[model samples]
Target: MATSYRVGIVGCGSIAQRHTKAYQSVPGFHLAAATEPNTETSRAFQETFAIPKMYADPIEMLQKESLDVVSICTWHGLHAPQTLMAAEHGARAVLCEKPMAVSLDEADQMIAACQASGTKLAIGHQRRFYPGWTEARRLISEGAVGKPTMVTGYVVDGLLNTGSHVIDGMRYVLGDPQPEWVMGAVERKTNRWERDVPIEDCCLGLTNFAGGAQALLQVDLTAYSSADHFTVQGSEGLLMVAPDSLRLISPDNSNGETLPTLWDTHTQSAAGSVGFESYFHIAYTAQAQGLRAWLDGEAGYRSEGTQTRHSVEIMMALYQSVREGEVMRLPLEEGAYPLSAMVAENKLPLRYPEKYDIRDPQRRTWIHREAYDRMRADGLSHPEIMATLFNK
Candidate 1:
């Protein structure tokens, strides 16, 4: 039997909970310690997970524990520094939450620190492990969908926070091709809850890849409802993976003959063919299993070096496009939107907005009015509409 690896978790947020669950689910892995800034929260997490040790500081946790790996589930801004600290302490591997860090320089520092220390880094893009998505890629590769030409997908959330997944997933499905240029538009239509937040609530972008493949991405935090829509359009067929189901439509009926319907007898003769519905739960479980395999080293997964750099590059490009009001090319120059620039400009609050002030009636009114206008434009106007409507 393989020796169980001792793991430490830093950060006690919701995502950390998921990581905790994943660790518990995987064999040859044991949750040994955890760290959080809040002493009470840290103690609570340790109690809840039956963790043997808890610390208010991650650096101290690393110093105290003999951990094989550490999962850095901290905020996007802190990912780099915390990851570097973890590596410096002799952790063999680090699994960091996505968006890697706020800037390329920070990402580079984290990567360099890990490389110098002989520690491996893995970015948490678990969606790549989803069964349906994996199956779709396999089918595309095997000529089930022919050559992929275009992809249309949207991640319904704020650009920096949730759009990271969409962008990462797109790259995964498209075989991680280098993007040549990107043009995007971001709209801050509502300032309802926290008018001071600087993050774009809605954004639409077009990406041109080096291989001639094109991608259309839409990300919004103010959606009326939640949705995960991914579609790949190939030369001879199309595949769509929605939040609940996977669908494939082919131009050739060679797979099997379709039955003629009385009301639409010409349906089968009209064109191609369609195939089965796949359950979401099955896909989710498959993703979990992939994480298990990666942790076990059953198969080599994409190194943290490539994934982190690519994700940060894409994010920076998106942000640049938004700021410059034009297309931004990749292979960003040395001075392009550095983290220092963001810090100097005081834009951190924009990316990580303060919680909405529910007690302030004026602020609530402003947010509601903005949401109402946005919803009305989207043809989903309703007084009782939840906050999700503006998210898509």
Candidate 2:
């Protein structure tokens, strides 16, 4: 008989909705309980998902439920503490969202706690499961694009929220190399803060891998509708990876001798990279698959805690590089929230959203502040607070 794992969700936010739907698609996983600090939101989530139990605190949920897995889909700052609580309370595994934590110290603490309690922790860099990305990795490993030398990704959002995907994606395609150093610069001209974490209007960085490979990251808020492209350059060919598409350009073999040219291109359609295929819900399903594999003692499952920590370390190193105006080395020696420190110092420039079609700046600011205060008072989840402000 197959074992069905009991699952507990820590936050009843927008992401939790996606996770619920994905869990419905996965076999041997039951959505037993959930936690949301806000009363109304928690009730709504419970009703929507048909969750059997709901609580106002995750620790309470952990204490009362015999959950085999706990998904910590909380704010950026709460991931570590909540994960620790979950591990201590006997969760066999935990799935957390990206950016891992705001600082390395917190990330280390989460790793240590999970290790101490024998809990398998997985960060939600589930895009690695996309067929397009996995195929790219396979092709790279197969030497289709011989000796990958450089990689690049263009994104349109904050580092932690959107940029982390690019970083993780690049890492995935490159076979997860050890990062040597990173040099970065950030422009903070916006009031783009996710909960308490500050977001940059534009951030660019170059990360050097141990074996002379390099990855370039360009995240600009101005490119609001950018296609979000990830490309790899190798000694023999070039490959471009997108959500719905994958393109490879290599030598053309035709009449007589074979010759490489720019005119020859091969495109692949990854049907799995479409709507729910490439987006939110499918990712959680992929996560479930990885979890099941690990539980079954399958080899080569990629969501281990150590690898996720490397991704988080790369993120933190980029921020540290931007702040110090120099190349930052890997395995950060110190732990601090560099972005938060910059925000506290008022080092970031105030953005004029009114010029960007956000008219009535005063009223909007007041409303956002009021909503934020409400969230703090009611202990609302991060997604709910964001929804209240943006009317989402």
Q: Which candidate is the best by lDDT?
A: 2
User: Which residue pairs of candidate 2 clash?
Assistant: none
Clashes of each: 14, 0
| lDDT tens digits by residue: candidate 1, 370-392 | 76567656754222234354443
**Residues 234-343, model 2: lDDT tens digits:** 88778887544567877742122222222101111211333543444455666777786676667646867778777678878888887777889876775887776776
Q: Using TM-score, give the best candidate's number.
A: 2
The lDDT, on a scale of 0 to 1, for candidate 2 is: 0.73
lDDT score at residue 358, model 1, on the 0-100 scale:
28
Q: What is the TM-score of each candidate against the true structure?
A: 0.76, 0.82
Superposed by TM-score, candidate 1 places the C-alpha of residue 151 at a distance from the truth, in angstroms, of 1.3
Instruction: Provide C-alpha RMSD values for all models, in order.
Output: 9.0, 8.5
Candidate 2 is scored at a TM of 0.82
C-alpha lDDT values of all predictions: 0.64, 0.73
Off by over 4 Å in 2: 221-228, 253-280, 345-392
